[model samples]
Target: MTILITGANRGIGQALAELYQDRGETVIGTHRAPDAGHLRELDVTDPSSHAALAERLGDTSLELLVCNAGVNLDQGQALDDGYPPAMWEDCFAANVTGVFLTIQSFLPHLRRSDAPKIAIIGSQLGSQTIASGGGYIYCASKAAVLNLGRNLAVDLAPEGFAVGVYHPGWVRTDMGGDRADISMQESAQGLAARFTALNPETTGCFETWDGQAHAY
Candidate 1:
């Protein structure tokens, strides 16, 4: 199976890409930084870049498309700063709009696969039932992506594609920090299991890396 992942230069995205590659799958890792070793350069924040990536792939069939590119702009921001208007713009741009654009631009490639699947890296924080505090921008952006993935599942189902939203767990990465609960390997393995089990029967599921259903 051939899989494409965004923001795979580092963090959980990198771990997932490496996991697939080790398992003998064709894994394409896309990154924003040109100097990111073997990862291809593709800025998820740029719509034109998505178009370019699609054109470059040119009808190449994709088995899985993982939208793991996202930003946590409001990390440690002060409430006194009122969430910083510009940060809100950047947060939504990278986290929400970027996911939608990636899915939209890659629809043709997805259609080429007999059993295409989309895995959106969302968060438990995105759940309205679980939400209870700060990081407003990050929370809101994740919520939006969760909603987007759910709706995309509905729209793309007739084409034999399945969409699943997942929380990668609090993995120890740059984004998750050292104090996080799980290691990158653990998250990657659990997520791989989740992805393998995703099918038309469970297309619109919002789940965790460890396989539990999530409230969203």
Candidate 2:
């Protein structure tokens, strides 16, 4: 299968891309850094970047597209301490709007595939039903991505596409920090398994890497 992943220079995204590559799958890994040796340059927040990415991967029908690029505003203070609007904006732009733009740009290529699947990496903290309410900006952005995936699943089902929202658990990456519970390899493996198991009938569901349904 041919797969495309965003923010693939490091962390979970890098691990996922490497995992797919090891399985003999063609991987188009994107990152903002030009020096990202094996990854293509892409900045999801930029429209031009999306266009360029589409051109770069021209005519390659993708079986899977993983929207793994994300950012968390470390506004560690309480929301009452005046939430950093700039951080919120950046988080939303990267985590939510970026997903929309990436999907829009790549939809045509994805349509050409016989089994197209899109998976957006979300967070368990985004679950409204299970939310304890911290990291407000990041939580809100992830929640938006979850809904985006759901809506996309509904809209794309007629075209034989499947969309899923997944939480990678607290992985030990730069974003997850050193205190996280799981390793990046473990998270990527779990996510890959979920991606492989998804079907049109299971679209619109939020799940974890381990196959458990997430609280919406």
Candidate 3:
């Protein structure tokens, strides 16, 4: 299977790429940085870049497309600091709009495949049931993607496609920091398994690393 992962030059995306490669799958990893050892250049926030990537892969079939590229622009900002307006813009641009654009740009490639799946990397913080606030922008962005993924599942289901939203767990990555609970390996492995299990029946499911269906 051929898989495309965004922001795969580092963090959980990097680990996921490595895992898929080791499994003998063709992994196309994208990065915005030219020298970031990416297999291709893609800035998820840029529509032009997505178009360029679509042109580059003209007719190649893509079995899986993981929308893992995201940003937590308001990471450590205090409520007193008041979430900057620009930070919210940047966060949603990468975390929400980016995911949608990537999937839209790659639809043709996915349609060419026998089995196509879209895996969105969302967050547990996005769960309305678990209102663990703090990072408001991150939570909002993730929640939006979760909604997007769920709606995509509904729209794509009749077309023999699967769309799943996943929580990679609080992993020790650049975004998650060293204090996170899980390692990249664990999260990547669990996510890979979850992705494999995703089908039309589970298309609209919001699941965690360990395969637990999470509350939205």
lDDT string for model 3 (9-29, tens) is 888899999999999999999
State in Å the error of residue 121, model 3.
0.3
TM-score of 2: 0.96
| Alpha-carbon shift of residue 197 in model 3 (angstroms) | 0.4
Q: What is the C-alpha lDDT of each candidate?
A: 0.91, 0.90, 0.92
User: TM-score for every candidate vs. truth?
Assistant: 0.97, 0.96, 0.97
TM-score of 1: 0.97
Worst 10 residues of 3 by lDDT: 31-40
| Candidate 3 global TM-score | 0.97
Q: Residue by residue across 8-97, what tens digits does model 1's lDDT show? A: 888889899999999999888998867355577788889888888889888689999999999897888788867888999999999999
- Ten contiguous residues with the weakest lDDT in model 1: 32-41
Give the higher-TM-score candidate: 1 or 2: 1
Question: To one decimal, what is the Cα RMSD in angstroms of model 1 from the true structure?
Answer: 1.2
- Model 2, span 1-216: residue lDDT tens: 888899888899999999998999998899898835568888999999899879877888988999999888755758567567788888899999999999999998999999899999998888888777577788888888988999999999999999999999999998888999999999999999999889999999899989899889
The local distance difference test score of model 2 is 0.90
Candidate 1: lDDT over CA atoms?
A: 0.91
The deviation in Å at residue 83 for candidate 2 is: 1.9
Which portions of model 3 show Cα errors greater than 4 Å? 35-38
Q: What 10-residue stretch in candidate 2 is worst by lDDT?
A: 74-83
